[model samples]
Target: MVLPTLDKPVGQCLTNLRRPGGLGKDPERAQRRAEQLAAVDPDWNPGALGWTVDWQRHYTGLTLLLEGGAGLEEIVPGVTHRGDDIGRWLARQRRDWARLNTEQQHRLGEMGVKPVARPQKTATRTNTKTGATKGSDAFTRGVAALQQYIAREGTTVVSRSHVERLPDGTEHRTGVWAANQRARRDKLDAAQLSMLAALGLEWAA
Candidate 1:
């Protein structure tokens, strides 16, 4: 598909390859475009046709026509242009075609192209205490230990009430509770604190 020129250069369009409205976003269109790209015959000739912008335009249009099943002889000159210049140029392109630049060639190759191979990211668990990558077992054990400790000593109290007015003019109330986990650690004796320190935890506050 011939995309319209945007605020940025055409080359930058490739940066948004899989984003919304990009060529690869629609699976069906992407597949069809890939088929068209792969169908391009590498043996086609580029004769004396030099690299002019108008010539390039006609050349691109001709290639698109060829992809759509127009044979060499079926591609007439006058059909591509309102003026005689493009018609004459197109007539010569039947045999005397100009070679496309690298950018155009690259664009042709990107049509429905498969994703290139790359290294995949591996999932890992981080050890919060050691700040290093470790097995999930260790992480899970740490979390469970912390949770058990918190449940054993954490003290909770109703801190406030949340009230809201209903459409029927009735008031709905919900209690908000606060827990003091640190106070539990602060209440530990020196011997308990020493035990926790030996276990490599900050449970003694």
Candidate 2:
């Protein structure tokens, strides 16, 4: 059986459904519930709302009653729902809707409710370019080496070039030009830094 399509945007559809004596028939309560649900859902969409064919069949008689209220009596066709069956389905819908927290409910808002996309879980990152892996024995050793190096030679001291004057008063020899140069000369470079990072270790600047 062909189920009716809901071309109206979700928000509008919900607004209509939640109005007093409206389609869903729950009134102001429905709108407040819808808003609460939307606020909690980061990926909430204002489109795509409707009841499934199965639901329509299950609530066929009730749907007929509700459709009359909403002027949509002809949407579902040829489903014979008993009065007892309709009463049971309506009770279930009420119970289910009442149980919703709007914060915790995933997709049970109404028929045709689609779940918003959940953020993807990221895997532990590996940097092959620098050969860095967290919690590895190698990484741990690298951090230890860095700590030892730092302890032996405190913070990087800016090495000033030693200006030597020749017999003629001309500069003869000069020391390292920059502190970074001194660091490199002392064997502290990107390799050590990468290792420290991999082991989640922080070094004093």
Candidate 3:
């Protein structure tokens, strides 16, 4: 801090400032002691005292950012050191959670009653072990046989269930029976069918 000057008040002031015990001065012994202390911090000059405190403040801020107090927020419950409520935070949490082992996620789901992925239900058709294929009823076969017989015999016989609404109206036969029935209800009188079977044919449904 001292500057050379002419022999005057300025000269005296400069001499005082340049003395070894001046405010910015260090003697040989003090310099050696400071060097010993600051050798452990090779990047710094121990003579610059302000650098130490400024460096400490910077380190504290960095630590705070990593210890959940500054910068961003981490919305992932207990998983991160940051505290950012970004738009994708929840989605990120879900992805991270899913990255855990299967058993771990399973345990979490069990704890929270979360629904696990399930196999999708499929459209299934039963494989019948026996009997006719679909759209073919026992009664249908019987009616077909009856129709063939009537066509051969050239005669009309009444079905007990059908005795009204004569379609032929030639004082002819009457019925609500359809000529082209694709579906049939398979019902037969068991006792009557048994009697018919005892005499001859089997009437089955």
Give the top-scoring candidate (TM-score).
1
Better model by TM-score, 1 or 2?
A: 1
Error at 66, model 2, angstroms: 4.7
Which residue window of length 10 is worst by lDDT in model 2?
196-205
Predictions in order: lDDT: 0.38, 0.38, 0.34
Clashes of each: 1, 0, 6
Ranked by TM-score, top first:
1, 2, 3
lDDT for residue 149 in candidate 3, whole number 0-100: 31
Per-candidate RMSD, Å? 28.3, 27.8, 43.9
- TM-score of each predicted structure versus truth: 0.22, 0.18, 0.17
Q: Point out where model 1 deviates above 4 Å.
A: 1-50, 81-87, 94-205
Return the lDDT, model 3, position 42. Answer: 40
| Tens-digit lDDT string for candidate 2 (1-205) | 2224856676555445433344344657756766776687622322222222223344445545555563222223332355334443333343334222353233334433233344576765556524434334443443343333232223222235543343344442222323333345345445444333222222411
